[model samples]
Target: MKWVRSKICGITRIEDGLCAAHMGADAIGLVFYEKSPRYVGLDQARSIVQAMPAFVSIVGLFVNAQAAQIKQTFDYVGLDLIQYHGDETASFCEALALPYIRALRMQPDVDIAQVAKTYVNARGILLDSYVPGLPGGTGEVFNWSLIPSLDKPLILAGGLSSTNIAQAVAQVQPWAVDVSGGVEQAKGIKSAEKITDFMQALRANR
Candidate 1:
């Protein structure tokens, strides 16, 4: 059976983090970018990290952050992986020395295969919806038809929810699906019921 892994992102509360873990989420994202409403402070991130159970990966998300800031957050939060959500060059991402995923915002004329090849060292290529000013967490779905066959693993994101995840998985058959606002009751706040429903939907499709 091909199981589609799920990651519940934008976790700001300890309870939400634990809920995601308990609900069989493969990973939980912690936002480090201060400008986003879903951003988590170092102390808050630490608390969430400490409270989470083992085996669930802690992914730290950044948006063109300085290396020093990333290192400081890594040391304090003990992130297992990094997700770069800005216009960071492959070299800059590699310099961090941590397993990372590169987010490619899918625009109308973007060349995904070429970008994926460019970031060939990335653990996976995360496809997200391209919004004019926002980096990520846009809560808007892109054209699933635009995705191309690639050499690296694929993690499909952007506007994924309980209602549409199954269809998205059946269409894309990605290694994983990432959700943030889709499972949230409000910005930075997750809804346990939504998470459970989303997982159930994904499992049913698989």
Candidate 2:
């Protein structure tokens, strides 16, 4: 478990958030992107974040939202980290001050080294599948071989299920892995069994 962090995203329900924490999620992502089916309002997010046990982080997901909007969300939810999942510039991301990650939409032969350099100051970089006209949470993985050797921490995401998570952990040995649709019964709904299975797989690999 040297580098096996995991994030459970698209959490809309308080029960699901609690379950993720109880089952040992390193962090929980609350989607603030309105267009996403997994989006949760500030009030709901506030309640869930407030109830989480200590050391389990609360991450807020944004997609090209304004500075004021991000500030509002942070004020209301008190996020431990922010995840930018759209075409946000490094300046926009850096202005937040709070720790954050810039997601790179993985595509065929994308220059990951350049991408990492562009956001060098970010807490980490999240590599996810490239899906046109869609936000994150597609549950479609990109070619893992495309990952370039880099100095920064990489967060592996997309199409990660319990069965393949151990394999992924062994191959990429990423700083963290993110899951949303892969462990879901439907959009915004999660399965506790899937969560347990995914963690078990990660542990077994360790």
Candidate 3:
């Protein structure tokens, strides 16, 4: 039997945070990138984190933000982990000294194996779809066939929802699956029904 963990990303409201945690999400993500439609302010992020029940991991997502900014967020939000979604170097990520995951956009020229080697300290490697101007949450699926066996845990994101989660999990068998827009009623706002449906689909598949 396989166990596929689920993460509900881009949680903004306290209700949404509680909903995701109550829906059996192993983790919940908060976007700190200002440009993202799903971005959460520091106060909002802190309140969401405070409202969450125990055992649900909180992940703080950032783009190519200044080190001071990330440090401030880490301190203020009390995140359990950090996720680097921009072109942060392995050394820079390591310097933060927080347990972190690296979001890798599956672009044509990306060397997955080499990247895995470069950030060997990442707790997991998240694979997201690549759009020319977007970092993540593009709501587009990448070619699962392009994925190769990796030495580290592989987390699949991008375009995941109740509609396709079962098939996606059956095919890739990732360490986890992350969803944002797919489970939202709008950007940064989560839909309770959609979240329940998505988790049910994933659990049934596993």
Worst 10 residues of 1 by lDDT: 112-121
Point out the higher-scoring one by lDDT: 1 or 3. 1
Look at candidate 2 and tell me the lDDT of residue 9: 94
Q: Model 3 shows how many backbone clashes?
A: 0
lDDT of 3 at 173: 89
Instruction: Assess candidate 1 and give its TM-score to the true structure.
Output: 0.98
lDDT tens per residue, model 1, 1-206: 59888899999999999998988999999999889999999998999999999899999999999988988888889999899999889888887787899999998787888988888579999999999989999999999998999788899999999999989999999999999999999999999999999988988988
Model 2, residue 90: what's the lDDT? 81
Prediction 1 global C-alpha lDDT: 0.92
Model 3 clashing residue pairs (backbone): none
> Candidate 1, which segments miss by more than 4 Å at Cα?
none
**Model 3 lowest lDDT segment of ten:** 112-121
The lDDT, on a scale of 0 to 1, for candidate 2 is 0.87
In order of appearance, the predictions have TM-scores of 0.98, 0.96, 0.98
Please state the error at residue 55 of candidate 2 in Å.
0.6
TM-score comparison, 2 vs 3, better candidate: 3
lDDT of 3: 0.92
